[model samples]
Target chain A: MQLKKIKSLIEIMDEKNLTKIDYEDKDLKISLEKSNISELEEDNEDGWIISPTVGTYLDRDKPLKVGQKVKKNEVLFIINSMKVLNNIVAPRDGIIEEILVKENDMLEYNQKVMKLG
Target chain B: MIKKILVANRGEIAVRIIKTCKELNIKTVAIYSKCDKDSYHVFLADEAYCVGESNPSNSYLNADSIIQIATNTGCNAIHPGYGFLSEDYKFAKKVIENNLIFIGPSLDVMEKIYDKQKLKDVLKQINVPLIESYKLKEFIKSKDKNIYPILIKQVNGGGGRGIKIVSSPSELEQTIKELNKTLKEKFDINNYYVEKYIDVYRHIEVQVIADKYGNISILPERDCSIQRNFQKFIEETPSSINNKKLLDEIKQEALKIFQFLKYDNVGTAEFLVDSNFNYYFLEINARIQVEHTITEVVSDIDIVEEQINISDGNKNEKETFITPNYYALECRINAEDPNNNFISSSGKIDILNLPSGRNIRVDSYIYQGYSLKPFYDSLLMKVITYDKIRNRAINKMQSCLDEIIISGIKTNIDFNYEIINGKDFKKGNYKFKKY
Candidate 1:
């Protein structure tokens, strides 16, 4: 997505008071999210990845650690939800800034799994 | 035995169940949406998990997610305190299929009671006096206009949501369409029924607790006539029913219904007692109710503990009726502006001072700095007061309401304070229609 288009989407999000939005076309796809926890005390500047289901978290082939560099769409972890393994990929290229959860830990939906920078 | 229970609810009821679990040495697991991360229930439970987003469909009503969390957390049973999937027979059935106990009525009892038409038929077989009712389609086809001033209600609607009063045949179809649309948008169910609307009636309900071995216990009746828009504002036990014979009759009728259905665990049977004291069976609430607090205070019984014991098949096999020792009253404090048609208000609580005394108890999940969210119900707390004398109990409730201090939002505290002190309430004949 173009920078101008992304800015416009952010503007739309602000106008509609939406927490997240997804845009896609034939060639490119983008998922944007913004924090609605302004009232909460623990607000952070870095992007946070949240769990999508209540299940056990498992690392891919190798264990992931903090400060590890990651690429966009790379398989970062898998969540075993109801016996089905769901691969959670990186939303964008960034270093593994903070790992909040450990491998084999049970994850609840919307729980903070990792932070990206 | 149930060593661990997943409480599939939130707010005061979750806290209520956790207190009992602590007493019984059963571990508790609480599920919350993201918005409820800082809720009191989360802090009180042995283990807490985020179910989903703030929307109930993705979180509280998400049966699959709830079941997954229970199985993963090693929960031996699930206690749906009230609302959400508490009365959902399908969810109860799924829990049994997954080899976990559902801490409520059996699947067969739930199925029979949930079907409004079938419930009425069963009651008819047992000679229960039910209100004259008809399905929406059947009522529309009938040419008889004698049943005018009928109430159009959603078959699946409870808690005073989908109900309308039509005075004449001319407005019957229009009201039905409106009710159907509202039901469709809310419950996704398009079915409705019409019942002969009694112009003057008192809302009284009986609490019944049964075991697997057909042992049923009927507690004291509660008078829930202090209502607005069909939602109860104040619930009192001993019911202000001066006649002991009438009270016994109501209990007998409730016991008969439970015995016929072979209902297990704790549930409520609601009735509409009219001017002449002719009681008409309304429906059954197949779960623990909000007003169960007052009954517990008066009867000196831990109903939640009883529910746990019954579900575990440890209850004694004998039927008994318990008379209340005190007159107890409960007022639900909601975060709503009574002056503005009860529109809900939400904000961070700056100060919280709950009332406490000799016979006063407050059941709530709010605390200082708690951010009241708009996504949930407006009820903030339940203030209960009890005494040997009914008048003294009302006076105690009036003083208790005055002592409550919740800042940073519009609450119905002042509104409730006025109701308890009003002349009608003092006279012991308060009517909802008059309110």
Candidate 2:
């Protein structure tokens, strides 16, 4: 996707409050999320990654610790709720600024787990 | 000892439960649908989660998800505040099986009361004043004289739906045909029952509280006769019956029904009182009722607190029970426009000028700038007033209704004002109408 076209698409999404949009005929594939990017970008100093479900925190194997560099979309930890595992991923590329929780810690839904910025 | 609780219902009732929990130093966990993100209950809870989509079945009624969230959030108890899953015995069983307390009546009370037939049978053995009921199958099989103007109701379960009044023998066959069709299509059942319908009756219900130790306390009965289409709109403490003997008889009957069911926690036994002072047993509501606030104001008893203490196995009841020395009335303010054929009106509340000052209590979740959703019940708030006399209570309630001003969406405030101002309501001589 062209930069101008993507910017216009983002503007349209913001105008209409659209969460995601995709257009493809032969080779173009794209998806944009306003809640993740636009909302989180306002607080850039500490990009807090919170649990989306109430469950027991189960850190992924070989998890990145505090002060460690991490990348966007990286699997940081897992929340096991009702026997279902939910992967908590980094919303953006950043370093592990702080680890707010430890493995096997009981977490309420939306509880802060880590800070990556 | 429930340190934390999850209010598995929403709107005003959830807010009510959360307030009660806060006072008891118990943390509250709320679950809401995506549509209810801005709901007051969600904002009031110590913690909240979006369990499912907006649909009731997907969100509030999602038993598995609700239980899972309660389990994960460390909620020691789940209070299904009236309606929804309050009377659902299976949901209560699920909560119990998961080691979480279900804050309501016992399993037997829930199971028996849910099946009207079983509850009726249980009440009958204990000499509870019950209106005679015959199953559809049995009535069809036997040769008996038909009671004119009978109430046709489903035997397996009871709901406002699947209820009709058959006036004469001419409508018996047709009423049965329609009853069977409605039962099958609406309830997926083929069983039903019929009871003799009285022409004029006043709706009275007794508020009963039982402890885990089986000590039961009955509050002075409330007259909820002011109803529209079987849905109570106004409820008042200190029933209209003047005869002390008759009132005591009704209260005794109510206690008997509660004991027979082994009911624990807070419950209400409704009755149909005829003009001649005869009362018959109606269904039992095994949860905190909507009109409990009126009884609370009059009796000076916190019913919700009592319910929590009972669920916690606390046995002290004599200290909490008090004879009501005041008269109180609750007017349900709904988001409905009476001039518009009572159609539900939903929009952002622009300004909320509820009645304030002494002797007035408004239990509501709506505030200025709150947008109401059309997916749920139309009730907006309950305006209650307390005084030493019924006339004073009624006058105070009328003034309370007069001082209300909700501008954005239409409200039934005016309709309630008319009812409170009407002669029939003051005399307590009105029957249920389709107003």
Candidate 3:
């Protein structure tokens, strides 16, 4: 396998909660394992968060207002670069646990754009 | 003037040659591999035909198929642009045997210069200084006193393949063995030669054009010292050399060598000039070079047209054309990452924003949906900038590169910026080895 593809696979393994992955091709052979991490706990008090493309996190503009309700897959914030633009979305159906980003905020790829319980 | 021509290659160079043919009012035919069904060259040509599969061995290098297509298309001539079968003497002979113009030097001339060792020996007889080499036994006997860091290069190779450096006597055998294995695998030849490696040598080449009736012209020299892995990254005309006499001597020696071989058509004579002003003959590229655009920009001459004119039986006088008021530089943008060993990256070009401005010329066939092929050279585009002064030319090139953008595949853009902004390059004090 190409070295770049291998590095990308490692990144994917680290990001997701998967036990193992294997791929084979005429010119490539790959096997990957993920480190043990806590399974995401579902909580009614928690909100859903979605990732755009994979990257790092930036700063937020403002804090969450108390008692605000947020729906699942709702637009939370935006992450961007000179060439790419990605929007963070609510992950699950829940109330806003805590608003993460401000009005004009920066974020990383796969970095928690918002806190989803 | 030639009435019709066929381009026996594909991709950017073929498209480039077609553009010039259009300007000269010469009808053009293009040949493509199956993988290049939607290539820009096909769209640009008056007519195009598929030769074979994407693999170059069955397609572009299939001289017989290409000749047959040319014959069927009623093309009177064929132009092999810089790669594939461009320098294949047998291909040239086959084309000529079909009673069509080859648009390059005769096959006999190509045979004399195809062998690197033989070419070096010939240049040596013509008084062109070259790095001295000893046989394997002689090298072993003189290891203690010989140069400390010389290159063990495959005798029949070019393009930096099958080359290794032997820094000390202890590493000589190991390096030679590895290099021999590589040469055998890549070129099917085991012969190699050793030469004194000049660390701070500048890569300079003279562009010469010859007609059928013995007329030749030496265009201005180009400094291609900014290179990586022996492949040129940046090239500029009006080299930083200040010694007029020495430059003239080098050009004269190159002309003498060309005359000795009776080489006709467009060719480049390369040299490695060291810090002490000593120049060593490198090799001759029988086909047009990748950086030929820089020479064309500085000299204001269409090299493709010149080749066609020569092939059409036009006779001209021997003369040296100098760059009048402007300097030009070219950057070869490839689909490779500098930080990752320059490995070829293949994917669809989702977005491609080519840089443009006054004095900027971008020669590329990439489009928004173009797929970067995995089977061919990784060169993606040639970005060139020109100005009246050297620094201006450099700045223009930097700005142009800044505006350029590509997605879905990695490139060497960052490395190009670093090289241009580096202090050594800014002062023009760097050599080809610095890359």
Candidate 4:
């Protein structure tokens, strides 16, 4: 059988969402197997507070400083997105190692705003 | 005059718009999601900014972030390129509310065109032939057996989602119940209508450009009949309909509709032509389409530039008649496994070679080492070929496809090559192929 025919058979299997297919005809016999693609990502192990949405970055009323100890769920910063202010809270109890962003800076989603140590 | 534009889109369309802005001496601002930060569109723009996460809702479709970026950058206009917010009436209204020019149709025109039912009603007023449709209650009451294979569709649906076909009377009620569930879950809306489904038909669309003034110019009709899952895979200009009279009629009806509505910017009127050559008006797309490249290749016109000009209130010279100079065809090369049910194939592009030369054009955003993200559409690039004859155009496209190579992931390039060389395509007898 031609390679094209086998390729097409694989397409039929995928379109049918089947993992395997077998075919037998008067003069032709074919079997195909398909392996699904695995989707996985490594977790971010380092301590980083990423912005959740695109907005204007602003400091809280009590400005957070480097080396400051923060409790989990404490409001660390504020992001004014589309006129709605979103509180960027600390994910866990840690000391701030670095302040990556400044006041009134435009921040993008997943951008590193600060680092915890 | 529009000085700067914020392209509220990504991928090839965003790159396509920014290229035109460069030619027209207009600055551009591109917004990218977190994953797209390293993409080509970001580097092509005069200024780029990160918007949100990789997901569309928090990124490309985040109208507020897009508008804020445009305003903060001092851009005079916002070009919602094709997908995200291009036909969004609410976003267009918000752009105007923020004192920025929305580079497409006006808010009122978009409002009517976005609603498929309303657009059909307006077409009916102008005597355009329309497929019979029924409201939910009326369809249930008048479940005529004649129209057995009826199509159920969302009133405000796109991307070919939540559409179902009932082939027999026994399957009608059950199909409706299942379709309603899908619609509610996918679109979060219970509103839907039933229409007579034409089993076999050709998809033909007319491209029109209109300014704020009543001046309208109609281009050649495009045959987008080759499709899979309702998404167009191949498109060509100067449809092989063989009946000049029928083609002319389709173009005339399209002109009349646009002239009546006084539509602004560039838009396309789609139609479904049956075996008898009887054409039924489909809804109009209020923005540029993915296949606009083929039309541009044949007509030698920059549609994006025209869009910007119209948005700037520059009047177009009234030209009622325009003809194509060549035959053009476009094949979309998607980063998907055609041998695996077209599932998106995403990975880093280790090796890449794109075709070039005369009568051939490529519009793409992929490059060497570019990682194909699963969070976006699978369209990798578009390869277009044009010649004075259709046969030559097909031949050129075949060679173009052969010259291309993309490794590290699967692509539909081989499939597209087979399609262009298929007997049905060679004889110009291809219709909407069921995949």
- Model 1 alpha-carbon drift over 4 Å, by segment: A1-47, A60-71, A94-104, A115-117, B143-146, B179-190, B317-319
Q: Sorted by TM-score, highest first, which candidate order results?
A: 1, 4, 2, 3
Better of 3 and 4 by TM-score: 4
Q: What is the C-alpha RMSD of each candidate to the true structure, in Å?
A: 5.6, 7.1, 17.5, 10.6
Task: Report the lDDT tens digits of candidate 1 across residue range A6-69.
Answer: 8999899988777899999776589999986532212233567778888889988997889999
* Clashing residue pairs, backbone N/CA/C < 3 A, model 2: none
Q: Which portions of model 4 miss their true places by more than 4 Å?
A: A1-47, A62-74, A91-97, B159-162, B180-190, B199-201
Error of 3 at B27 (Å): 2.0
Give TM-score values for chain A, per-prediction. Answer: 0.61, 0.65, 0.38, 0.62
Which candidate gets the maximum DockQ versus the true structure? 1
C-alpha lDDT of residue B150 in model 4: 82
- Cα deviation of B163, candidate 1, in Å: 1.9
Instruction: State TM-scores per candidate.
Output: 0.88, 0.79, 0.74, 0.86
Per-prediction DockQ comes to 0.56, 0.16, 0.01, 0.40
Candidate 2: misplaced stretches above 4 Å? A1-81, A84-117, B136-145, B152-162, B166-186, B190-192, B319-322, B432-434
TM-score of chain B of each: 0.96, 0.93, 0.92, 0.96
Instruction: List the candidate 3 regions with Cα displacement exceeding 4 Å.
Output: A1-117, B134-148, B154-156, B168-172, B175-191
lDDT of 3 at B29: 89
- In model 4, the clashing pairs are none
Per-residue alpha-carbon lDDT of model 2 for B1-435, expressed as tens digits?
Answer: 989999999999999999989999999999998689999999999999877667888779888779988887889999999878888888999999999999998787778887776678877777777887777666666656567678877654432544777877768888767655765656433357777888556778889989977798889888887776567888888876566687788888887777777778898888888878788888888889889999988877788898899999999456333478788889999999889888999999999898988899999999899999988989899999999878888898888988998889998888888988889778865665545
